[model samples]
Target: MKAEFATAERAVTLGVRETTDGLKMSMRRQVTSAGLGQRMANTWRGDNYPKGQNSIRAAGVVYTKASRIMEGFEDAAVIRSKDGWWLAIPTPNAPKRGVGGKRINPSNFPEHTYGRLRFVYRSGKPSLLVVDNARASYNRKSGQLRGFRKASDRAVSKGSGLTTVVMFWLVPQVQLPRLITFNTEAKRWFDRLPQLILKNWPD
Candidate 1:
């Protein structure tokens, strides 16, 4: 599968098409693998890699560790794709309509009829919102954001204070079954949400 994080203004796409594709994704991230960051590294076109590398070194880390990171977000997680690509596709402006996917911020966000993605983070950790819309545009983008600066209570833990959260609304391609609480004690995150939003959002 592929992961796209797009915004009306900007978008970043990441994919793991296959074993070979993972390299492609890493290449898009930084391109330091084959010394693309240096003189020995270069792409078919005439693009100059700022980091001075031909492969994204971090992606390898991401692939080996994406599931570990998702342990607190989904019942199961894995990196699977074929193209192995990554990019930030720019857009004209904010989406004409916001990502109203199901099992999302129902109180604040429009009803999500399609798909949604949720990830976890500690209080103050870096976070983002990734989007890849197939009905409108089937591409991956991960830059900017997909929701509010402050995450709604719909997806937070019971009594958990406001913290960092990354979202990815994969309309028609949501990975998670539903929003869930992170079990810090068990060191596991499970999917157990109501079919509809709770009438009273417990603070």
Candidate 2:
């Protein structure tokens, strides 16, 4: 009688599935670890960014979708939607919420969030908030901003009048240090698929 062995096709399939599940779980865990988020957050909170620009560090880097936006002080750190997973830093181009809960375009944010923006100068100079080519004046007596309005011909004719409006953006610049850190590490995990399957194979 010829010696034969039963086919192990079902066992092989099961092994593959189990290894896949394990690897997926491991990847998820690695990506969502608090340590990873904290590391990314440190990068943002630190002064290492270009020209010492203050970055967002409210939550550092989180794993959830950007749709679950977080508001920190007057700044916001939002994530953008991607295929599997991704993260974003608060960029100067980040959108702002206008009246009636409308999403104001980044370029138009200066106009939309006009009243909320504040302008301060370290030196002895007039610091005025300008929005949408209009200067915002505050009513000191009422403790309320008068809002934006077009400068009249008389106002425009004055040379020193323009200097009174110190226009600047209020949005924070979003960065993605996590992308740089996680991409290579995640690839390494994916490359170990074969070894993972074999190591997890049934005895």
Candidate 3:
């Protein structure tokens, strides 16, 4: 999960007596800038920026640790549950944040904060985790169903507005489509190598 650029080869081509350290620093800046641009593009969810650290310089080579995530943009990826269990896909009604302000999943979901959840199986469709006697209210600002509250006995009675609200969908696998322009950005920065070397040429 890395991209390595041999700085020595480019430095040789440019006939520069500058140190590889200078060129490596220049390349690091460009790679950092490129990563920032991708983050701004809003291709994926959450803050994927720091998940992959900035580029590193080693022995005349500059590389990045963002390969695994960037590779998904180059090709489609099928993600399966790590524990051989169904993947819980959160629904709009599900809480967005869990403990430590991270995205909520079945593992870290605050069930007690919401209500008791039950599984509902479907004959031909994915099974769902739902709250039987809960009510959901929509938030106009976020455009999502939030404010899940337990229904009182009278509210759960007939003609009551309380209904089963879906929290998550259980699926075996999920296929992620190609979204980011990783190769394009890589080539762009690669093409600028000559200029970068000159810019950071040893003073």
Per-residue alpha-carbon lDDT of candidate 2 for residues 106-191, written as tens digits (9 for 90 to 100): 22344433333344433443333333234545798996865444455576566333323334433233333332333343355556
Model 2 stretches with alpha carbons more than 4 Å out: 1-8, 34-96, 100-175, 179-183, 199-202
> Which model is ahead, 1 or 2, in terms of lDDT?
2
The most accurate candidate by lDDT is 3
Rank by lDDT, highest first: 3, 2, 1
Candidate 3, 72-183: lDDT as tens digits: 5447788889988788999988888976689987767776666777888887788899877777678989878656877766777764777778989998888876654545
1 against 2, candidate with superior TM-score = 2
Ten-residue segment with the worst summed lDDT in candidate 1?
Answer: 8-17
Per candidate, the number of residue pairs that clash is 43, 10, 0
Which is the winner by lDDT between candidate 2 and candidate 3? 3
Candidate 2 residue pairs that clash: 41-60, 66-79, 89-174, 89-175, 90-173, 90-174, 91-172, 91-173, 91-174, 92-173
Give each model a TM-score. 0.15, 0.31, 0.57
Worst 10 residues of 3 by lDDT: 44-53
The Cα local distance difference test for each model comes to 0.28, 0.38, 0.60
Off by over 4 Å in 1: 1-114, 122-124, 129-203
Report the alpha-carbon TM-score of model 3 versus the true structure. 0.57
* Local accuracy of candidate 1 as per-residue lDDT tens digits, 151-192: 344534443443422233222122433222223311211111
